[model samples]
Target: MADAVIVVALLLVAASATAAVAQREPARQALVLSVLGVVLAVLFTVLQAPDVGLSQLAVGSALTPLLIMLSVRKVRRQARAKDRAR
Candidate 1:
């Protein structure tokens, strides 16, 4: 039972990571990355590392995606400003 859960979690992590990498847009990629982070947290928990999983969930699922989205928004905003100036 435990082995099966671990294997499933591992597979989910792999699939989500691949999905994240395959995304073309930064926003979409960030969304997929957030999902990947949650999947990774699950994998860590299944591996019996709740401490690591908790931190991963907080950082990967939340902070990383938020930062990426903010960065994308800032860049797009700058590009728009530049276009306006032109």
Candidate 2:
């Protein structure tokens, strides 16, 4: 029973990671990466490591995606400005 749940979590993490890698757009990749992070956190929790899970939740699922999205937005704005200046 527990093993099955663990397997499912592992599968979800693997699929999300593969999807993240396959994505071309930064925002899309970030979305998938966030999902991966959440799944990883769940897996950690299932494995009885709530501290690590909480850390992953805060850093990987939240901060990492936020940073990626902001970076993408900034880059896009810079690109638009460059185009405007041209």
Candidate 3:
């Protein structure tokens, strides 16, 4: 049962990652990646690595998502600025 849960979680993460890659919008892609990260973190916890799981949750689920969001925002701002400058 545990192994099955882990496999399902991993599959969800993979699917989310693929969806993120297929998405054209930066915000949407970031959101998908964030979801994938969270799913992976959950999988880690289920696998009995609490420390690794917490670290993954903190870095992947939180920090990475924030960074991605910031980067997307920055890119959008830059694009808008360039458009205005034209």
Candidate 4:
């Protein structure tokens, strides 16, 4: 039972990682990366590292995605302003 849970978590993390890499758009990639982070956190917890998992959850699921999305928004905003100026 324990092995099975670990395997599932591993699979989830792998799939999400692949999806994140395969995505072309930054926004989509950010979303997939966030999901990957959550999966990794679960995997860590399954492996008996709750402290690591908690930190991963906070950094991976929240801060990373928020930063990526904010950067994307800023770049797009700048592009739009440039186009308007043109």
User: Evaluated with lDDT, which candidate comes out highest?
Assistant: 4
Please say which candidate is ahead in TM-score: 2 or 4: 4
Select the stronger candidate by lDDT from 2 and 4: 4
What tens digits encode model 2's per-residue C-alpha lDDT throughout 3-51?
Answer: 9999999898899889999999999999988988899999999999999
Ranking according to TM-score, highest score first: 4, 1, 2, 3
Model 4, stretches more than 4 Å misplaced? none
Candidate 1 on 6-76: residue-level lDDT in tens?
Answer: 88998999899999999999999999999999999999998999999999999999999999999999999
Query: If candidate 1 were superposed on the true structure by all CA atoms, what would the RMSD be?
Result: 0.5
Candidate 4 lDDT, 3-81, residue by residue in tens: 9999999999889999999999999999999999999999999999999999999999999999999999999999999
Clashes of each: 0, 0, 0, 0
> Whole-model Cα lDDT per candidate?
0.95, 0.94, 0.84, 0.96
lDDT of 3 by residue, 22-86 (tens): 98987787778778778878878888888888898888878887898999899889999999999
User: Per lDDT, what order, best first?
Assistant: 4, 1, 2, 3
* Models, CA RMSD each: 0.5, 0.6, 1.7, 0.5
Worst 10 residues of 2 by lDDT: 8-17
Superposition TM-score, candidate 4 onto the true structure: 0.98
lDDT of 3 at 76: 89
